[model samples]
Target: NWRSRIVFLLKTNSSKPMLHLIGNRPSADAVNQWAESLDKLLNGTTVFSIFLKSEFCKENIEFWTACEDFKMLTSRKARASKASNIYEEFIKSEAPQEINLDLHIRNDIIENLQEPATTSFLAAQVKIYSLMENNSYPRFIHSNLYKKLCAAARQEVKYNKS
Candidate 1:
């Protein structure tokens, strides 16, 4: 499973489920759920990142999630390699989608990279997670993108029974 968790930073699971919720806890079926609610708008979803594909900050959620997954890895070897890759792609100043983080956090990650622990990105992950939990998650709930998808799902359900 460490192998799966390692490169997880590089891959996106499109089949990941989307949840339309307004509370911290999810239904029995929520594939991946958030820890808390989103300003009375939405809860969370693993696939919510895809909904943000066209947005400039879309990488925030997914990158945060990837770091979380990477932390869960049981292999130190896997953590060593994945840590640097995630930092290179999402945390570095010149990265394609550099995440906003404190200078201290960046320094800590660089130091951690030398020994690469499972929690190397913990601080950065927390910031990204908060950014999404407070900002993007709420905005996404009100976005037409989610509304249209919900409407289509309802229509499909109705048509299926017809």
Candidate 2:
């Protein structure tokens, strides 16, 4: 039933790219062609900076340290609290960080990959930032860029441990 549902969804969801391979049918070439087309369209374009705010780690301090590049604003609970000082303090402390072009490639890989993939994609953010800094570009981020960054970040976080 789930496989049928996935097939039906893929058939109907033309807006989203098809998974290419399903069951025994091979889809590598089709997927590769589509990916090449997408690559041409997005070349030289950067999505910009992303502000990360996730509920995944909750209050775990280790998670906080790992994501030091992100401005760890308030906890999710603080946002929902009766008094939001904790959230306010968190925001006040966060230094700005931005997304770099690495996000675009990681997303492309995840979208085209057949098997479940890991979250090592997030490491791209660090690598890209380093590249930008080496090239002498100032670090700047924007809110809208988070969509791709979050997708790649979530994917990396999802597959990293395994």
Candidate 3:
């Protein structure tokens, strides 16, 4: 029932305005930036995130984003705390949002948790990033969502000029 509800929401909202989906009219350049790299794509908009949710793989990006935020922490205490949270959420077996990772990488992360540095999740993050870049990114670029976004962006450009 909950899964059906989520599907209904996604379907119902799919036809809503671009602003509702992405918060602003994403420029053609912004859409192009997404194609260039995963970092640019994640930093640029939430539409890709929506797409990932539709594909039922949003956790990959979520974990990646969390890792990025985790890297920016300067305080060791903060880093340690975040490291535990991240591991619990995305690294530990049966985690709520467990990511697909190699056993060795996962084991390494578990060991690192004893100290919990900023880079504790770096290796796992990179693995997930590679999976998204090589797999999800290409599909997203070709999806109807991306096509509609591009069309919306082009329309915005035209409207701006006229």
lDDT leader: 3
Worst 10 residues of 3 by lDDT: 1-10
lDDT of 2 by residue, 14-112 (tens): 443232322432123322232233232123222211111221212222222333423342443422341122222222234122233344554553452
Put down candidate 3 lDDT per residue, 1-162, tens digits, no spaces: 433433344465465434324434567789767778877888846777777889999999899989989999998889889999998899889999999999999999989887887788888888998999999999988876666667667777778889
Give the alpha-carbon lDDT of every model. 0.62, 0.31, 0.79
- The deviation in Å at residue 8 for candidate 1 is 26
Regions of model 3 farther than 4 Å from truth: 1-23
lDDT by residue for model 1 (47-160), tens: 365545545687887687678779788878888888878888888899987889999999999888878877788888888878877777777666554444454455545666
Q: What is the C-alpha local distance difference test score of candidate 2?
A: 0.31
For lDDT, candidate 2 versus 3, the one ahead is 3
Clash tally, candidates in order: 0, 3, 0
Better of 1 and 2 by lDDT: 1
